[model samples]
Target: MWGVRSGSLVRRRQLARTLRELRVHAGLTIEAAAPLLDFSPSKLSRIENAHQGVDVHVVRSMLDPFDVGGDRWSEILELTREASAKGWWRAYGLDDRGYIPLEAEASTIRDFTVTYVPGLLQTTDYIRALFDASFRRRSEATRERDVTVRKIRQERLTSAERPLELLAVIEEAVLHRPVGGPAVMRAQLARLVEAAALDTVTVQVLPTDVGAHAGIDGAFTVLSFEGLGEPDMGYVEHPMGSTHVEKEEDVTQARLVFDHLRTVAYSPAESVSVIERVAAQM
Candidate 1:
């Protein structure tokens, strides 16, 4: 929670953990704590699970009963304020599927994509083309907003203070497929090559020749945070919706898949060579 700011999923999770621990230390069950704070059991549960935000007033109310005072009380209250603040993504009208907040706080991002470039490495033209090809047609404004959000998210890669380390494994077939026509694909591939030059970024390609692999299921991202005492998080997106995996076991499994992919995929240097070759073809 030290580095986590307002509207961060990490902050929410930290707050939730602290609150739950406090309640446990106070010997109060969720049932008992809910009424004391004038919150429904379900509402309290959501807050403790990081699914909902708590106001500073409510945080104080909840902590008072547990004899939490002084700096500890002040810190929790400040976190509450930050937790309830609106995130930058909200301004774009994007739904908080919980990924962005986590991404913002992640120290390392490991992504494996089967069909397209990872959003973080995608060019604006590629994003536009992908959206255009989607079955669910969105308004122009919505599409632009989505692109803007992605552009903002990409800033984490170049952040001077604490840049995020990105390890991306892309399917070889993805390079062959034309996302936004030859021109767009060429530009996107060039972008990939450029990004690969960054010290923080590592791009690898999973050759199509290696048929039937562990990543055949779908694409997933694993976000690792700095010293927050929180476990690694796994994220999966599909046609229906996105899923965030927090359980240690599941995250570890995802990590295993990613590790396997790295072994099977081309090395970073080879991957860049492949990308450059593909761009020439395009």
Candidate 2:
């Protein structure tokens, strides 16, 4: 797990959760607390939301309003510093890869795809083909960088230490898409079978006959952390943009939907058989 050791993303979220709890425990809301510290409510709210990290001195000032000090105060300040640290993904300068940073830190991923193969299970050829099909052309350097990023992300699945556990349920239509042509699709499907054989990975296929199933809304990934303090996250991407779902209620609903999808999808072994049969046909 990327977060099992150093984790800026998880730490930032953890800090935000703690500060929000502390403010509420002190009987103050963002609007009320901001005035006491001469801060705009939005600024303080952003800090509590982990959108921005405050300097240690600013944190001290913020904590004073809540009458917090001693060890607890020091702990939060340490967390703030940790949260402000750069994540491993930043070294690659992946500004366009919106979800990789979070995905890297996640201990587990529960993905349900209605139209495409999950990134973690895609073959190199399949990856390049998807990029080639993009409406906007990418330079060779940019394309290869993305390919490298995907390969690196896949390492977590087979790591000697604490590999990431993946549970994926995909629509049967995904197998028929022939994303990169017959050869590429065959290799991609074969890769799925290979990955599913791992103890950390489980793949299931939702049959075409399961009409109007639970995941009709589209694809979404629910990422779970080590549960030390960080909450699970729900990520959804669309053509226009992507957003992270952080609310406890919404994330819980995502989990519930995923659970239902798993139930209606083929069993792991049966799913592998389905994938093999499809690849054979290809």
Candidate 3:
């Protein structure tokens, strides 16, 4: 059996892809593989879909029938172990940790926000104020945990190993909205200006004057991975829960919408100017 080790969400996703391909290459369906592995079809399906993790023993069992061995088999076993390991966010006790892992693993992130600032670009004070105003009341401890999580998420932007490339387009109205009052907004705008200066980050503003735009519908983020052989993921957050869109067609549509928003939004230089002007007003 493969040895157990720390698993990352990215590895889980990669393992899912490899397992599905192996099954196809072996000319077996989920129905056939399930009985052979003594797994329920749904359980096997979930593993292939990356909705759950697979043990090293199970991975070896599934691959054994396929006559898959050598480096490919070893690689999959390692991924199996890594996929079972918990991410840092899991310790936070937050209910919905779906998006952070994807964000952490993404090589490129494209975001469009119609309301307040994107979480990745938000300031500490701005995050506090937004949390306070949220309808679902949270304890101070919970709020602090939330803030810590956001701060940790921002580390990827400045990571020495693999800095994240962020392309963020925000609505002009967001700049005008007073989330944390003048001082907070000023600081937040300043942070945006500074972040925009970074080589890995780009900030653009969608002027309110551009009425009836493609992004008028709502906000979303598209996360692209680095050589993971996984499809780009699309995330849509609503009042109830978030939706992760994985279908190629849906992901393509989200990408197109982001692309259109990019074309309509102000240039980065103009955006920094607008941010500075807003900060001066505050």
Query: Model 2, range 155-186, lDDT digits (tens) per residue?
Result: 98998775899999999999999998999999
Question: Which one is best on lDDT?
Answer: 1
Per candidate, the number of residue pairs that clash is: 0, 0, 2
Candidate ranking under TM-score, highest first, comes to 3, 1, 2
lDDT for 72 in candidate 2 is: 94
lDDT of 3 by residue, 1-282 (tens): 012223556677788888988999999999998899898999989998879877999899998877799998898887787777766777887432488877766789999998999898899999999999988798999999999999988987887776889999999999999898988998999999999999999999999999999988899999998777767989999988899888999899999999999999999999999999998987
Give each model's whole-structure lDDT: 0.88, 0.86, 0.86
For residue 203, give model 1's deviation from the true position in Å.
Answer: 0.6
The residue pairs found clashing in candidate 2 are none
Off by over 4 Å in 2: 1-10, 22-45, 56-78, 95-97
Question: Looking at model 3, which ten-residue stretch has the lowest summed lDDT?
Answer: 1-10
TM-score of each: 0.89, 0.82, 0.90
| Root mean square deviation (Cα) for candidate 3 | 3.4
